[model samples]
Target chain A: MSLDKHAMAELIANDIPRGAYVNLGIGQPTLVADHLPADSGVVLHTENGMLNMGPAATGDQIDPDLMNAGKIPVTELPGSSYFHHADSFAMMRGGHLDVCVLGAFQVSAAGDLANWHTGEPEAIPAVGGAMDLAIGAKSVFVMMTLFAKDGSAKLVEKCSYPLTGVGCVDRVYTDHATFLITPDGVVVRETFGISFDELAARVPVKLLAPAR
Target chain B: MSATICDSAAEAVAGIEDGSTILVGGFGMAGMPVELVDALIEQGAKDLTVVSNNAGNGDTGLAALLAKGRVRKMVCSFPRQSDSWVFDGLYRAGKIELDLVPQGNLAERMRAAGAGIGAFFCPTGAGTSLAEGKEVREIDGRTYVLEYPIRGDVALIGAHVSDRMGNLVYRKTARNFGPVMATAAKLVIAQVSEVVDTGRLDPEAIVTPSIYVDRVVAV
Candidate 1:
């Protein structure tokens, strides 16, 4: 079975344990929350002040008052608490979180993440809380496509985009493969398990995915 | 009574007192009221409760106050997102208070206060712990939680331009909370990089009219 972006995202969400304090990075990374098993006690933390978040609302139940950093409306799960902005971050920086799920524009072989800033001066330079979440969470899981817009491998030997946080990524779940970064190198434990030379043969340009 | 003209940033923010609640404008650092925050820090004010979207990157915007040991409490949607130096520093020192509200909720609360709305029912905190002690009401068979209005004693705003009459215009993210907080405070003080003449400011560009403004200071 060939897995698509949504399928890979769902597979990643299934791995999150119960009672996880997680942060969903903006963009496609947000779709993971929808795939989370209903039985798991995962608490979604938005850097914009929310914990124990649920899926997006359907109809007029949508409260314009409750939204994430993207300003999109969301629903709250059981046992949710609203708090002071600093306290929400205290949870992140204090390392009280279990996992952080983020979207990446690129992931280097060393597991560097570059998702926030595009390095273009004309682009908005705002990094927001991606840096804090990447480094602060116990585990950082990046969800991204395996390739770039121009068909170049986004899983690169080194990220061309400006880094949001250095060497903080734990595992990368891409549309094409799920790769784990370890002390040795990139290990393709599941989905795509080609040897280093074989993996390099699968694409053109420099190989950034963890070298096994 | 002699009218004292305060020209410097420190002199302007000296009017604020300890334990006072202040509103700061800007989504990020794009249009933060830097001059007023600087003045507040220079004045060495203490035990302040600040309301803003996010603390500016450490050493700027609201983070400056968080760094100076001046702020006692912060009411915001995303304080830690900036990873500001002061957030960790002050929080660990136990010198600051924090209250995290949903982003849209905080904005609405400020707007509610400004619009003279006492309290409203929202479905934001239904099944979550966010609804712990609040009154839960059912309207049309659906449950809604109550949210209180947010107001401040003073609103410290940054503006692109302001007329002598106090009409204000904000640029980019600086427009985030400026207008809402303007009408939600007992006193409104604006720091404008440029000051202009009345009636010259485009009507559509006026985020806050002079009626809600109490004082204007040129940065």
Candidate 2:
């Protein structure tokens, strides 16, 4: 069956192994938290300062003390514990995370990542913790739009935007297609309904399809 | 008629002046003191120094101040890179000075000030460039780093609800900076969505007591 971005995200989340620690990047990637399997035991790690956090609360039934790095109020599972901020980043940069799902402005076929800044002289230069997660996670997954608003492919041979992490991204999930980066080239995992070559043509680099 | 607080945004922010240093309570996007921020934006106060964990995104939070060229300095740890028009403009124009504090130290510094603890030391930034020029003290054959107190002239905070007597409760992430900075500021103004009767809130739920708050406004 053909899967759109939402469906693809849900499918990928369903496959996450039980008890795996995962970090959800901002934007569309943040939406995956809504689809975690009820019967599973996956734990969500928020960069702000939450672990084993539940989904957002509906009303006044909120705890102000529990929030993500973004200051968004979040729920705490029974086992959740709060610690020093550096300890949280230590877990991230020390290679303790199992997987990380991040949103990307651009990803290279060679597994490079560039999602932090746009290099606009008039833009804020806050890198936050992207560089830490991209290099620290055991495996990296990128979620983004298949193409930019200007009709250029965000999945390219090399990123033009400043790089966040070099040759680190392993899986690519997008609105129109999903692929895996390989030593040979960009290998098609599942294009869902879109044509592989059609999306590849938009990319600035050479494309090589995986052997079926 | 019983006494009432300012009835308009203008009156709400009339006390704020140019070149004032303010501490705001919020993690990043959560529990931001929206009403007071809106009032400040509307009041158009300029050349302000803001201390917070994150610079609110463009058109929101502290970012709104940057958008208006009202901010003269920023003391924060995180500011998103995706959108940058407001913050970048202020930085590039040399109108803003940035002080990047480690998250824990920032929170602790405010807490220490609020608690009237003049200064404290920790090993958080020790052996790193973050420790540059800071006093280093050793005790019991161990090294500890010294960090100074950072208090604000005023603290602008958001609460889920507050009582008539000024006890405060914050929702989830909104609780991050509010309670700590409440006591640290000379004047604390809480902007809440609802105002309740005294003793209406659970004793355990009160994050900031009436003593720390000078004023409360229903958003």
Candidate 3:
């Protein structure tokens, strides 16, 4: 069976180093905060001028003022600090973040990311912080499904959708497999519920064998 | 003390005319200046341009302004949240225009305007369609797109408290864009929950100093 969203989050969480300052993009990538180990020492940053953000708040704990870029209520940990919007973006665009996890509409074999818009006329071009996080984070980890709902591969030879950043994604964690993107080529690190050969057959691009 | 207090929200935004560019402070509903926005609507200013993080959360505030067809254009980062139906409907019908900026770039452009910088290069949106029509330069072997500063004709902001002199304090994350918007606008009108004496506010607690504020209306 293909891994669900939570399983995909857990898989992505495995790669986050301790004490890393991370930004969780809207949607599935935000789930990574829930699965992070308590001792991981990860400091969550929100683009709207908050640092040390905790998991999503629920029920009575929800504070309308305490929300992420997605406009969802969230809790704050001790030592949380708020600043002006400019200073917050300075942290993201200035290469201060250790890693940022983002959801992708498409990722290319060469590590290009396209998550902002589908280029549809009806689609609202809400770029948000994706372009900043995609290029600003020291390492960008894209969490998404291997295939779209239409059974088409999201990992492609070239991204058909508008790009958020070029040659920025370092790794991709999908329901079917985890791929490491290096300058040389795409490398399959591991697979779930399928063999390397099966995963290779499903994808459009050539996948290189992992270095032993 | 400076007498920056306005008797009403209408008085605070009285001079805003058609085609004026307004910098609205908030992220979602957190720090929105509802009274000031309502006054702008009641003022019946048409063909206005708004700069904010999001278009609007629901049927009130900025959305109401858009619904009334007061806004001709929106410059924002995220304009497609679930409650942003007004913008979506107008944009689809070609009634309103949209200039989508990356969140960080949006914030930096405002800051650059406030800080008196003409133009600066940013690494965000370097290789994307957003970079189109902008100057591109390679810095330290990396590409950066040049973005100009963004200033506004007026700014409507919300704060927790404001002293008579207009020194403002914000509640938690509600301060999102208020501080920066205050500096970038020609006339800064702040909606505060309460008004206090100048000496009553702690020097360190003030987020936006009185120098940048032009008017204050307690809602």
lDDT tens per residue, model 1, A1-212: 43676887798789998878888877777888888888877888876556787777779757644566555677777776544344455577568888888888888777787876577644423445666576668899988777778878877787888776667788988765678877777766455444556656754434444445
**lDDT string, candidate 3, B69-132, tens digits:** 9888999999999989888999989999999999889889999999999999899998899999
Which candidate comes out best when scored by TM-score? 3
Q: Between prediction 2 and prediction 3, which has the larger TM-score? A: 3
In candidate 3, position A122 carries an lDDT of: 71
What TM-score quantifies how close candidate 2 is to the native fold?
A: 0.60
* Interface RMSD values for all candidates: 13.4, 6.1, 0.9
Residue A170's lDDT within candidate 3 is 98
What DockQ, between 0 and 1, does each candidate earn?
0.03, 0.13, 0.83
Model 1 chain B lDDT-worst window of ten: B1-10
* lDDT tens digits by residue: candidate 2, A1-212: 45666786796687677889998876677777777788778888876556787887558746556766544566778887543334455677567888889889999988888877787876665555566677667889998877889988898877888777767888888766667887777777767666777756666767667677
Candidate 3 runs further than 4 Å off = B1-3
Q: After superposition, how far is residue B67 of candidate 3 from its true place, in Å?
A: 1.2
What is residue A82's positional error in candidate 2, in angstroms? 1.7
Estimate the TM-score of every prediction: 0.55, 0.60, 0.97
Clashing pairs in 2: A48-A69, A63-B172, A64-B171, A64-B172
